[model samples]
Target: MTASTLDAPSAGPADTTKVKRAAIASFLGSMLEYYDFYIYASASALVFGKVFFSKADPAMGTLLALATFGVAYIARPVGAVLLGHVGDRVGRKRVMLLTLVLMGMSTFLIGCLPTYAAVGVFAPALLVVLRVLQGISAAGEQSGANTLTLEHAPFGRRAFFTSWTLTGTQAGFILATVVFLAVAGLPDQTLLSWGWRVPFWCSLIVVALAYIVRRRIDEPEVFQAEQQTRQVAKLPVVELFRTHAADVSRVLLCAFIAVCSTVFSVFGLAFATSHEVGLSKTTMLLVAVSANVLALVTQPTLAVLADRIGRRPVFITGVLGCAVMIFVYFKAIMSGNVPLIFLAALVLIGFCYSAPNAVWPSFYAEMFDTRVRFSGIAIGTQIGFAAAGFAPTIAWTLIGNSRTNWLPVAAMVAVCCAISALSAATARETYRVPLTELGKRH
Candidate 1:
């Protein structure tokens, strides 16, 4: 049978039940994956320096801690290649299960690690190892989840269904910020001694619950039929690059938009709460939590709009909107006005940022046939995401001794957003493309 014929669901009404199940599974799995990720982000910004790099000067230690955060991105590309192969070849369901377990275990081990005071060099070394594992797992989580959800969704609603994968990420960020917000309010000694680890440890419970939900999800019927028909590529990465290089390049550039996320969620947190900026840690964390909470509401709505309109207009709008809003958000942080900070963050992250964040799942996945969709997205996004991993460190260096001058950081975000939007503008509008027709050469 042809690929399209294999991809068609049995002749019947759409299985709304399976679609909803896939959405929930994708959401919970993504939520757990990002919760593990963002907690490390929160700790790196607020506590990792004190816990694992206390020997360095305060500024140097914070930079080192943030650098460790980037270390995972290095591993992500590697994981993307390896796990993306599994998702594309073996099964998306298998890759999803494996990634979740790896992330949960690595995060839990991070909580159990000894501090620098106890283990000296061994402490940071171990932290880097665990971070690498987290990176690898994360590389596969979103792409696999997005591919699964998109394939399972009914025609014309792909954006809305797949958006839940990222919406779960917003939930994860909010959940992480809330946990850290509580820990940030603890006595300094208490926070440093044990509070920071609590969130990482709590990951175990969520991981268990996600595991249960994901286990119940059947492999998408399209994927199963593709397997039965032997349409799966022998090497998905090779097929992906050979057939869809431009699409992969576009996804890579579009992925740079993640710099906006790291800046807002990671570097911005450190910048605002630094001694020079004089904002409270809990307050900054709350800003992140509130903005992401709003995104949880706005993203799916925006995805529905993208389905009705087109991915390009919706995504480009968000990218350009973020370009403008980054300046306002950072300026508000520098202004020390708590009310202004919340307002700008809400606009920047909650609304503007949510646009691309919501749409990219379906947008990027649409660029590849199901045979290589997982690898295409994972490889492209992971490569671009490596920069996001280190963006906080880059911002730190750019703003040296000039905490008040937020221009460099804002400029960096503006440039990244501009490139992402320009690249996205070149993409074929896939809002109306059939599932099996995506990525087919003309």
Candidate 2:
């Protein structure tokens, strides 16, 4: 059980081709998954209430739609435990394939579901079920992809490569926003009846592309070497909790940094469009798309910086920056100035948020040995992400039914960022930890 005894054979010189392929695969897969995820988010913010909860008051319907969006997070922890087990015990590639298929199917079904006008109460209920499945699939996608890319990357550049997994997420968010913006521009009747489903159905195309890319990706050499040595854990979740409980705790809190994302992307969208603020849906979507497009460029740059400096500083800086910027971003929304909104969103999301978004793949994965990396990250992040999943709904409730109050919501996001930064500060800097030496207790 000692570190030396558990160490697998060195993987030798990293295969540059495989490293590039793995990064591409991880990026595409994450893009596919988040594409499915964010479309639902955009729909919830734009039209799901009218589509699925039309019988309720407008405010109540919107709240319900947003609530269904959060329902997926409820299933993520369960998926993390189950899918993470498969990733660790079976193989990363297999889990990737399974999660991609599951998400695609669920999102497609959501597109096909009847509206409340047609199905009465059944519409929202079915929406919730599909969202839960999407949540489960997403639970494993990023963590598994991150583990795969990191293990394939050349020594000293893991953060740079792993950053692609998140860059793909920004791409997905942009794609989702663009599609929804087009659909949102449709007349209200057509949009409510059918236009909204177009984005959900489009997931099938991305799913096919992701599957083609993912099928070609081999499991990382490190994981294969561990399997050869019979070092793969039989129950990775159990082993992870037993041996790396503190690390798990740290990842959990640090993962709460995601709250900033949900607030910015989801609640902020709702708040900006509310009658109190009256920003156009297209304008808000434009802001999101622009910021995310900028993030796609900035995230990898910051990740490269993390590889040179350390994950902790980059991550903490992002967290603290988000705490302050959440306030600024929302205040700009309240000001109803398009120029100010875009500027605040670009700086807060495109730059500051990109730091942790790019770094966490390596930062959290490096906290565990190869044997439990997937499960450790999956479980910890899913647990923390549950809060992120519900953040919009929580913010909505805190702002009261009118949705005019922005202060409490900003305060909530700031607190989440503060907790995440503090938790990350407690973690040992693992940027320089050798692959074989990671998670080895002294």
Candidate 3:
């Protein structure tokens, strides 16, 4: 564990007001950030092909769009290093502010970019640059937000509070998907022309609101205490690598479980609505929105369970459940069984995935001392998240416009989920450990 500093003034104990403020700050910030982020995912799946890649064949355009969406993941590790350094050395609060501004600017710019018809290849190139910026900004946002909230929270309430960050993500995703579903139904000419940009342009409003919420909160006492003690690492990225290599690897593998979340939410939505599947886009969108609502409710409940039992068990179970459920979920999608699809999405994404979604914030963050917790999580998880961010693209490539034959795609998702579950099983249980001794061996 990193040593505490005595040079600075002693901070007061964690209080309810501080805890609520921290959680709300993280939640609202993440909600906005993810709203911007999820809009792109929805666009990649539903709109980017028609608007940005009009030159390519229909199937190829959609694949290229999904590829652009995946390209952001490639920037995440870089962003993690840069922003993780800021969070650890400067302050989590400051890095968060910077991330918010970056994401907001990039997302808005994406809304304003020219289309393939107007600017040819330059349009997609500009889109890629903006997408990378969004990825970089997002890479640090959640980890920093979760860290701030966890450090501010009472011992037993860490999971309960940190869970809000993910709940916010679900809410953002729901909002984004619903908006896209509505806009997508416009007359083809209007929908293709300017309607799709509405969501991206609207991101400016969300970012501004998030800034107000996030800027009001102070750095958590735990980090402040570390700063006073001069235990803040000069290079958080390096320190994280040296001290918590195993934990980093474990987090990377565990993050693969997120493939379940991404593939089911984004790719499944696309697959169900594609001509092969013949389902209405609105039906798929409704299912996604409804399932996410259930997730918002279940995520906090699962997080509370982690606080009582342990993070590993909850995380492991969630991963396993997601892996097992995905096969049936895809089967339901292929069957064109509307009721089954709705129920499966709810059971899989809403309930099963929430186990890891709600708990992993604390589970991964607790794997390192405060000195490098941010980097350990940001880098490790982003590395694994690189795989997840590409999950839709991977599914696209595997399916290759073949929505009827989803067996192979389901297997790929299952494999990733299985790896995550096994990794979680191997990781140390941290719920019972004292805050100061969290990352160290007993």
lDDT of each: 0.92, 0.90, 0.86
| TM-score rank order | 1, 2, 3
Clashing pairs in 1: none
**Lowest lDDT 10-residue stretch of candidate 1:** 1-10
How do the predictions measure up, each by TM-score?
0.97, 0.97, 0.96
Clashes found in each candidate (C-alpha, N, C closer than 3 A): 0, 0, 1
Q: Which digits, one per residue and each the tens of the lDDT, describe model 2 over residues 1-442?
A: 3334322334565447887999999998998889999999988987888888888888888888899989999999999999999999989999999999999999999999998899798888888888999999999999999998888777678899999999998998988888888899999989988899899899899899999999999987778878888999988988998999999999999999999999899988988998877999999999999999999999999999999999999999998999999999988988888999999999999998999999999999999988899999999999999999999999989998567888999899889999999999999898877777888898
Candidate 3 residue-wise lDDT, 244-356, digit = tens: 89999999999998788788777887788888888887888888899899998999999999999999888888888888889889889888889999999899988898899
> Model 2 compared with the native: what TM-score?
0.97
Better of 1 and 2 by TM-score: 1
**How do all the candidates rank in terms of lDDT, highest first?**
1, 2, 3
